[model samples]
Target: MFFASDNSGPVHPRIMEALMEANQGHAMAYGADALMDEVRARIRDIFEAPEAAVYLVATGTAANALALATLAQPWQTVFCSPVAHIHEDECNAPEFYTGGAKLTLVGDTDRISAEALRAAIEAEETRGVHGPQRGPVSLTSVTERGTVYGLDELRAVTAVARDYGLPVHLDGARFANALAALDCSPAEMTWKAGIDAVSFGGTKNGCMGVEAVIFFDPAHAWEFELRRKRGAHLFSKHRYLSAQMAGYLRDGLWLDMARQANANCARLVAGLRAAGMEFLHDPQANMAFPILPLRTHRRLHEAGAAYHLWNGTLDGDDPDQPIAARLVCDWSISSDEIDCFLNLLRA
Candidate 1:
């Protein structure tokens, strides 16, 4: 039973086959390959933004940081939740890419409320030239806490950004999973809801390593390209990246994989709830943050279960003390594995 991370999962077989097929021919370097053209077209069609500009990078960090750098100025501060991936997980890549733009934690919780965001934005730019100006608002769907912001919540937050005349960026590292959970279209979840840019992820879904940086306005395209190149994220053998994305988008495979992953998480959550387990966060998307006893954790670990303890370690002496664990579901995790994990926990 492996639930460490979606990143640990194998690339889907179809994606591997696409890579193999792409290996047969020489393609243009630096994202000019025919596969890139297909990918761009497919993404634009999916998002219903015919004029949108889509570009690929090998990592989610590159996609998010570069996109933010393109949107916000160095003198400004990005507004986000304290637990946002950009704030917590990226290790200041956004700050580095934006050339020293600071991150302002909007709320104590993972989900930023509209009121909190407005107050944070207003609190900034009040200090004049001596302090950081207000920058783009960055929101993460499928937040690190394993909770998702509903469509209305997304719109509410983005509307707050629009009120301040600031741009908005979405850190969509689990874009597909969130999409699958919400049952919403790409456009509805993004630009239509006031998102200026997006880090459309594929690696966490089923692709090897590829994330697309999409700008609905398309005006950020040139700046993003320059930033990506300057950041040294440009791959010479770029077709490989293109091929992965093309394969991921093919035949709605991205949605299918995300649905499977979410289903797995739901099943895991259901089983845990049935056993009267308490949870840190409501299981949502492809992640379930359940609070388990330390003794149960040690037993699961000993039984060959793989997952990360969120708030507490397994070495503690208190057997009945509750600590949180982060269980992430990959598209490939079988139902048997979930049941096996549940059984181990029960035992």
Candidate 2:
């Protein structure tokens, strides 16, 4: 059983088949491919933003960094939660892409409150030109802690940003998973919630490596294109990227995959609860942070299950001591795997 990360899962067969089909014939380069046109049209229709500008990149980092760079200035600062992927996981890519802009972490928790965001923004620029000016506000839907921001929470944070006329960017690396968990429309979770742009994730769902950066207003389109190229994220073989996204959008495959993933996680969570495992955070989507006895951890590890240990170690002194683990479920993870993992934990 592999629960290390959604990124570790295999690409869907449909996506791979689409890639093979796309490779059969040569198409235009640099996002000029016919498939890219279809992908863009599909994304626009899905998001219900007829004027949205959508572009695909190979990595979530590129999607988020380039999108943020388009919305931020060099001397500005991006506000986000301390647990945001852009803050904790991106390793300064956002700062690099924004040309020295800083990240102002909003709150101590995974979910940033509207009051905290307002305070953070207000606290900035007090040093005049010597301090970083407030730039765009970035929100992660399925936050790093695996808890999702509800529709009201999302709107609250975005409303605070909008009050100051700052643009909002959503790091949607788990976009579909969050959408499925919340039962919200793409538009309702994003533009309708005051998000200016989104890093619409596909890699963690089922694509090999494709993420789309969607700008609602389209005014930032040219700037994003330039930033993408300058950041060395532009692919010469752009058709491959387009093909992955096209297949992801085709016939509602993206939603189906997300539903499967969330269902798998739900099953896992239910099983863990039955086994008396304590959760560090609520299992909102496809990711879970559960705390279990170290003996159970060793039992699973020795059984050839792979997952991340969030705290403590396998060889620690007390077998009964609790340790947290980060478990992720992808579309391909079956009910059998979840049951096997739970059985192993009980054993």
Q: What is the C-alpha lDDT of each candidate?
A: 0.93, 0.93
lDDT of 2 by residue, 21-104 (tens): 999878889999999999999999999999999999999998998999999999999999988888888999999999999999
Best by lDDT: 2
lDDT of 1: 0.93
CA deviation > 4 Å runs, candidate 2: none
- lDDT score of residue 165 within candidate 1: 93
TM-score of 1: 0.99
TM-score of each: 0.99, 0.99
The deviation in Å at residue 159 for candidate 1 is 1.2
- Candidate 1 deviant stretches above 4 angstroms: none
Which digits, one per residue and each the tens of the lDDT, describe model 1 over residues 175-277? 8998988998999999988888999999999999999999999888899889999999999999999999999999999999999999999999999999999
Candidate 2 vs. truth: CA RMSD? 0.8
Pull out the clashing pairs in model 1. Answer: none
* Residue pair clashes in candidate 2: none
